[model samples]
Target: MSPFQPWAHGLNEIRFQGGAEGFSREALSELLENVPLAIAVTLGPQQIFAFANRLFRSAMGMADEDLIGRTVSDVMGDRYTPEIRALRQRVFETGEPQELKDASLMLTPGTTTYWDIKLLPVRGGEDQISGILALAANVTERVRARSEADLQAREAALHNERLALAVEATELGLWEWNARTGEIFWSERQKEIFGLPKNEPATYEFWLSAIHPEDRERVVGGVGALSDPRSGGGLHAEHRVVHRNGDVRWIVSRGRMLYEVVDGELRPSRLLGTIIDITDRRRDEEVRQLLVQELNHRVKNLFAMTSGMVALTARTAETPKQMAAALRGRIEALARAHELIRPAITGSEPSDGETSVAGIVEAILAPHVNQGSPSQMTFEGPSLRIGPKAATILTLVLHELATNASKYGALSVPDGHLRITWIKGAMLTLLWQEEKGPTISGPPKAEGFGSQLARRSVTDQLGGAIAYDWRPEGLQVRIDLPLSQLNA
Candidate 1:
């Protein structure tokens, strides 16, 4: 055949292969060039860009002429790392099609792009490898969505961990039971709470065996009712349990039935719940109730004793003035003591039993201040709040000191200052220092109600010691009480 004939046959074959029916070589070239899809032609060994279509140039934001002669490295710069370059080289050497799905690429600063990259190996006449034909589809939005989903999953896991920690701190336990399989799963904390062996098999039998014998039947019945399909999945109960070591405990169990598909039909498959121990709380409530009963009984007894004292004082009073004064003083003292004993009867914690020291002082000093004489009284300390017994006894002692001060010492004069300063040490020390009053003498002529009550309160109720000194300055009384007693 002639050379012209061979060239004509070759052109015809190229036209047929290019899918350009009844078209010449020039027409086939024009059609291929104008096609919308991106296409590129590269040469062997160097993989230099030989040609590029309009779409390929537009996708990369470049002119076709600029991209045609430039290699991938020249056009993409450092965007193509050594690893990716090696992948392309492997594709060229193997002549195999390589596809990377959801691949990430950074095309601009602070902007990320994703792509599905396909590296198709092109072949020459003898089916020898020429170069790789790389095609990429932007998939940035889909990749971003997947990333957000993964972030949400991680946040959910962290939240769950925090919630579990909170539950553990509060001594709560959780469990789940598969109704279909009759299998129970207990959290490690739940096992510890129920006093079960860590290696114990989690099952209905194991759970029932651990329950207090008296509560086991009730717990089982409640759970059975909740798991029943006819009951519509409502079950909750609180009961008592006896642990392995014979310790009685209170447990509150709550769960609901969850349905799932098995084979074909829907059926109850699980009971998920939590258990909490309420033993200490229950005992505290019982104690509070008992204390309330005891308090009522004590109040009645106190009233009877006070009534008898008032009757006796009335009979002994020689005149109306003495009768009124005695009645008022005795009533006030009784009120002060009653206030001190209130907390002890109510079973409140020692800290909660604190009363205002200033109030106690005022109550005790009221009767003595009634003598129609100007007396200066001042209290100083590191703002102290003390328990019931301490307040009562301290008040009584201060009253006795004020009576003495008013009768003959500092409180008897308008200019006299009765400074009662209390310093808190390992024990509480109260100093009643009198200044500028009547001249000092010896001890009192006799022990009166104020003195006797003061001594009794200090020694008995407060479990403390008191000393009276006739100092040249004034009559100074020193009181020392243990912190525990004063606080309690």
Candidate 2:
């Protein structure tokens, strides 16, 4: 073979033995010089570059003389590290061939590239190396793609870490409930919220059993409301739960109801939510409520006492003008108290100027009692909403009872108490009992102005019946009103 014979087709023979079968030595040289991949053949020991193809010379910005007979370090300059230089020559000295995938190169200034490289020994047919064959395929695109994918994976992992930190900072326990299966997946914090062991199975029944009995029904109802479109697929409630260790904790749960349509009907499928321990907040609210109640009681007692004083002031007038002045003062004061009781209904015309039965009762009787007077006057009943007309009629009936109590019944003594209870379902039923008051002899033989007004209010306006049971201890009045008419 000529020293300047370019290069042989033996490169194809070494790795892929018969790959160059039909090609002559001159034909192989012509093929490699124009091939897309960079190829170089170098002489032994010194590993001097002997044959440089067009693609390889173009990449190095050199002609044949610049690359041919030049070592890898000579053409590639100092761009490659000493370790890589040693690796290239180590194959030559040891007659060993090496295959490298995704090898990096910086032979040209300010440019980087990658390649799939194969370094193989060329022998003289005696199993002795005569030269080295170096072949490489451009792999920069594949390497860039793999690098981008790795970067995206790392970014996603970082984002999840940040989200977890935010959730922990908010002290929120996340949970997901599978409605159909009754299985629940709880986050680490949620398991802590439920006082479950770090890794215990969380079933729907486990959550239900933790609720305080008193709150279970209301909580369940709140959750059930999620099925109603009016609820906007949202569930929210404040309830008490008993931990496994018997500690009662108050929590506020807020969540969204997930649904899927099946068989033409909407069905609940999942619920995702957060639970927050609100025991401290609820306790503070209760304390504030108690304080407000105390203030309300004192204000009521003061107003009632002032009304009584006004009546006494009326008796002490010296002249007609003086009597008129005193009477006008009392009237003005009573008007002010009325203003205080109703407070002008701050929002939205008071349900079209209507109010609930409880609202009416509270307004009329709030001026008469303090905390000590509950036994003297108290209320017991589920809440009921009533229109303004019924509230007015009921208000008048209650006023009459209170007036008689002040004059000759329960309100007359410190210990005498008035208890008002009502039940509303099919009909509205109310019971007014005056106990420990001055003994009532019997129902009055003739109805007074107040008594007649109460009768008319109940029967005509409220569509109800009113009867009195004059017991030995006190008076018990029973009133039952038709609900359909009142609601209408």
Model 1 C-alpha lDDT versus the unseen true structure: 0.71
Q: Tens digit of lDDT per residue, candidate 1, span 16-76?
A: 3435356665565577577644566666778788766665666566787788767888887
Candidate 1 lowest-lDDT run of ten: 1-10
List the global CA lDDT of all models: 0.71, 0.73
lDDT of 1 at 407: 59
Clashes of 2: 2
Candidate 1 backbone collisions, by pair:
none
Residues 1-488 of candidate 2: C-alpha lDDT, one tens digit per residue? 11122334455353433344566666767877897777888877777898989977877788998877788777777655665566577667786766667778886767888877667676666666777787777788888999999999899889989988988898888998887887788988887877888768887788889999999999988888887655788878888989989988889889998888889978888889999988888898886676567447646844764565456556656777875754554344344333433323222344324456666666667656767534467888887776434554576677667766776898889889888899987889999998998998888887765577679768886778999899979999999999875642
